[model samples]
Target chain A: MDKDKFFSNDPRFKVAKKEAWIGVGLVLFNFVWWFAFAYGLGSKSPDEYTYILGFPSWFFYSCIGSLIVMSILVIVVVKYFFKDVPFEEEVQDIQNQSDKKSS
Target chain B: MQEYFLGSRSMGGFILAMTMMATYGSASSFIGGPGIAYSTGLGWVLLSMAQLPAGYFVLMVLGKKFAIVSRRYEAITLNDFLKSRYESQWVGILAAISIIIFLFSSIAAQWVGGARLLESLFNITYPIALTIFAFSVMIYVIIGGFRAVALTDTILGSIMFFGTLILLVAVIIAGGGVTNIMEKLIAIDPGLVMPFGADGNLSASYVSSYWILVGVGVVGLPQIAVRAMSHKNSKSMHHAIIISTVFVGIIMLGMHLIGVFARAINPSIAVADSVMPTITMEVLPPFLAGIVLAAPMAAIMSTVNALLIMVSSAVVKDIYLSYFNPQAPDQKVRSISYLVTAILGVIVYLMALSPPDFLIWLNLFSFGGLEAAFIWPVVLGLYWKRGNKYGAISSMIVGVTSYILFHQFYPNAFGMHTVVLPILLSLVTFVIISIVTEKKELLQAVHK
Candidate 1:
């Protein structure tokens, strides 16, 4: 359990950590935001059954409208912010180096 | 085919998108989900949209990190990643068992869906239909493997995409436009036109929880997660996100809308699940109806094959090869893998012979059970470096046990779905156990 060696101010781990938080943060934000807009805005009124595009107002915005918004948002997020982190090769390199040192 | 079954790990954007949609869209989406919507009304359509972002969540959350990490480990299955990451046989074995156990319900749901579809379409007896579907899927899966599954899914996905459009148009025409359909529905019950269902049965709290269950919690499903390990690059993931999102949006809204509309046309349907095939046959010409019918067949076959492969891979690769015979030859592993998959299919077919009430419930139960069991271990194990095997095993145990208990004794506990409580409980258990074990392991490492 040489935990320190793996975690000790390792530049790769640092970058990986930052990337993870940003990714998780963005996903969580979208999950909450989407549900709010889908249900909160769409189903605000209980008694009335409003219609949009011949659909119940809540359904029109919550599903069809929200789906269009979601598609665009997902593409934008992936394009601009997401990075390709090479976790495999980096982890393997460290393991190889350790094996050599131990021998 | 070998690469296809075992993943070539070099799929392009279009193939990746098609495969993801095909695998995710199942008998439930095509037959069972639409059936439920027909009876439940427009409220169910709104709830089904929670699945619109499913592909996005799985691809993005797991993303390049999971693919790269898996390549580094040369891991194939979700349980393979678990075994390597946690460095424990117990964790690996538990994961394999969980996948096999939970996936049965999913596979059986597909079988029943396929049989029901066939029974209606061919006008055959239920037993004959069941046997036909069972044998066809079993033989095709055994022969085609994962490559067969992916190729078929690509074809099936395209059918569903076009089938949805054609059916929606045909159905709208049959019902004398959406306006007339609305009039008929309003005539039956003004409540049918409401957002909260015909009787206001759909609650705000319940709707919100479905967003968690089908939307966010999809990241935990092994069959879906395994797709993360197969793409060529980040570009494929991005493409998958856009294509699948759009396709799912249309398929869900279109199919379910067709369901709600079916009531206005034929309100006296004896069985709700038959509504889809019935409407298709009635609206489209006989020649075209056959093509449209293939979409559900495709959906059922694709879903069952994916589940079968995942279950078999979990058994052969994770447990048998890893434990009993680490040095078993490749040919032997392949043979046993095929055998295990066939046996699983037959078992599910038997279960579907006397189909129980609420077939989709079995599928949803599988979804929640898998989400609870694997969500914490997979997500935290990747993100939180402090996570270890003890935490992984304990998290799985608590997650699975609580989900089952809650499902049986206290479903929709506190108005939210059973999954919400178990996922939160497992998250707490994983972190606490990890922190407590970290120091002791550190001390032991120092002693060593």
Candidate 2:
């Protein structure tokens, strides 16, 4: 087995790396928004808390609010940015190229 | 054997999403998480939501390249991927051993959860319930195979989603309203309404560290990672990412909220794991109650099914087929696979006989260990061209050992979960070792 030919010899790996970065960004956004709201407003005493939709202001913004935001962002990003690549073997092309050279 | 293990990798978006959800949302999320929420209050609910983006992380990180690479390698299992990528027999064997050890405990915990659910629902004895649950699972796994599990997951995932919603609405109504529930919870304990647990046990550092345990590091789980290869195309992968995130959000948020709200309704409930089912019976009609109760049962069954298939494949495909019987015929492999699945089911059933008081810890323990061991190897193997077998083997060895040591002796070291330190250590070890070994190999090539 040729070690150098193991990875897909095309832009597919690049596409995956880009998508992975976007995923990291989305997750970071989720954490930052959730942490700020959950800790900022939620640090107060219950009596000191204001309620929204019968939830503590922080809880609403942090859990439910962040969830809705994440869903929309995920849909938009995956729709616009993510590529639809073939799931089959890309290394086959590399093998063919090497075989032609050898022949 | 390929179809038996991976359904020939022909799954579409919807089945892919549902199967991943059903497999990931185990008894821990359904039974143990809510139980903790019932005791810890709203903070635990927030903590559990850290798992909301789990599907997003797995699919997005391992989405396209993982599929292409595995197919190129002709890999059917996670260990096969590791073995091919790292080009080391030891790497494959170590991965298989890790899966068997960690997943064994997880499967036993799920069995215990299934039996306990039955005992509470039907007034059946524990042993009888355990026997019934084990047989049903073993029979389907032996006969229906991976396709059956995937198809059944569509139904089970739906039950979990709608059941959580229905039971949540009922609980809110039974408590009079959200405001009423909040007030009651406040009256019982004001801390219940805050971001921290009722006892302030949920610190910011601790809760945030769960992002690794259940969130980002979930990409390392073999049971979940293998699903990345099964989708028909990257289009389905995209669809699955969004669909799974939404499903996970609803189930995790709704179930934990119901757990917290149960405290408002019945403040004196003794056992915490019973909170979900107990509240369902209290609030909904008997018929509706039965339907809603299926949510946790769905969670338990689907999870056990996935784990059983994974462990079975580790034995038959990764170890047996690779090492002992590489030239074994398809007919021989098929029979051996079924026999192995049944035998593993019996072993887990025996383990479940002595039930643990709280099974979530066992599940979490397994999660942390698997994540630490596999995260660096899998992630780096995909992106970093320089990583070699030396790096992979050392990373896994160091990851598992340090995780156990930290979990045993210095838990919550630096106010983070036990997993954080091991992950960091393994990453460093992988990089340094891989760089050193790659240089040595280059020097050898020059000399030759």
Candidate 3:
């Protein structure tokens, strides 16, 4: 019951760790994009505001625009980068056996 | 016990996504959120959209390792995961206590919102409405358990999505289109059209910090994180990440937009929580409004059901079985589960009877507390091998205490949410303590 080896030695852990970082990166990206448009374009007085498709430009870009873009980006990341790992208990047993054979 | 608590961990992508969305998009988003948006204007919408990445962050962060490890540990609840990860009885006890206390407030918020929605929708008295909502939710939860919740959440989640889209369009049309609504909102208050609030109360820092409360920090919500362990496989988990992100983004954006636009049509509504129902009844025909209003009901019901199940499991399985009656028979455990769920519903119902002015604040307060308490222990415990019971126990204690003290004395300290400071302190505590104890454990191992 080597707990450290049990987690770290599994191939799934490495992939999951990598994906979690990407997940965090995506969240940060969402915040930065949201902040830039929300605060950057929105900092001006409301009198100087412009409209796009009936939405005020700042609200349009910041909330609606980010929603569309983040949705697409999340789908792309999951489709391309994320892998399908088996959840069955036996998969770990198989993984252990394979590891023994390789070593 | 497995089937009762976790639906035998057999949920697929759609059910997983729906259950997660339905659970996360609770009375706050459906009612309290929109109510605030009704007054605060489009800036509040932008602020609420901080929740756009909630499902994505939770599933992605806790996806694979959480599922595999929980399965390995035979864990059913979040406390179960904590108990095994730290291998400390105190960690499990502390987690159960936290879940019961914080989740009670949140469940009460949902109850208040649900009763209010019913009161507004049916023109019924608040007490009757509260009773109706409580009875229906309890009956199904006590009888059907987790599978019923997941299955119903799928239907309810769809209702919420389409309901929001319909209400948004209806509100727009009733207000003479998007351009006209914008013009009217501007004429009322120029700030209404800006990224700041109608009163310019929503500052940039406060809004950005919400990303932690509703976005990334969502990984720490036990109700949501528990879903990460229940998905059938990694492929479905991937599908769920995409599906839930899309659903949450649209529902949040649409509901908030309806709230803002409702201001243009009916600027005189008094209570913020009533804005959603009032506007729906105003804009749509009676039949259509009835259907649209059910969306919030669905949201509240599903959320309450999920929380009820979790709390009952925490009390019955985590506390009772582990400590009081380890050899309790299946029949007794089942009866105790039903009894706990019913009693919890009654207590929350009583709490909701005194209804707060803004249930959203209550909801978000609980969110901050839960996130502050569990974020480090759960996340660090999953990743860092060195993290142990001391780090977890210290982090939970520090995080929960500092969060409460900050929330009490100085909410939104430094223009950031009160949750920000405690989460930072807890992270530091977890790392330093884990490192210090790693050496101690190493010494003990060598002596052995």
Judged by DockQ, which candidate is best? Answer: 3
User: What is the descending lDDT order?
Assistant: 3, 2, 1
The alpha-carbon RMSD over the true interface for every model, in angstroms, is 3.5, 1.2, 1.4
Best by TM-score: 3
Judged by DockQ cut-offs, the docking class of candidate 3 is medium
lDDT of 2 at B112: 86
* Superior by TM-score: candidate 1 or candidate 2: 2
**lDDT tens digits, residue span B1-448, model 2:** 7787787787888889999999999998888888999988999989988998796989998878898888887788899899888888999999999999899989998998888888778888889999999998888778877888889999999999999999999999999999999999999998898877999878999999999999999999999998888998877888899999999998999999999999999998787667777888999999999999999999998889889999999998889988999999999988898888888988888889987878888898899999988999999999888889999999999999999999999999998899999999999999999999999999999999
- Indicate the worst ten consecutive residues by lDDT in candidate 3 chain B: B55-64
List ranges where model 1 is wrong by over 4 Å: A1-48, A84-103, B1-5, B443-448
Poorest 10 consecutive residues by lDDT, candidate 1 chain B:
B1-10
lDDT of each: 0.80, 0.89, 0.90
lDDT of 3 by residue, B180-227 (tens): 998899899988888889888888988888998999898888999888
How badly does each model clash, as a count of residue pairs?
0, 0, 0
B330: Cα error in model 1, Å = 2.1
Better candidate by DockQ, 2 or 3: 3
Q: After superposition, how far is residue B223 of candidate 3 from its true place, in Å?
A: 0.5
Candidate 1 reaches a DockQ of: 0.29
Residue by residue across B313-394, what tens digits does model 1's lDDT show?
8888888888899898888988998888878877887889988656788898999999999999988877778998889999
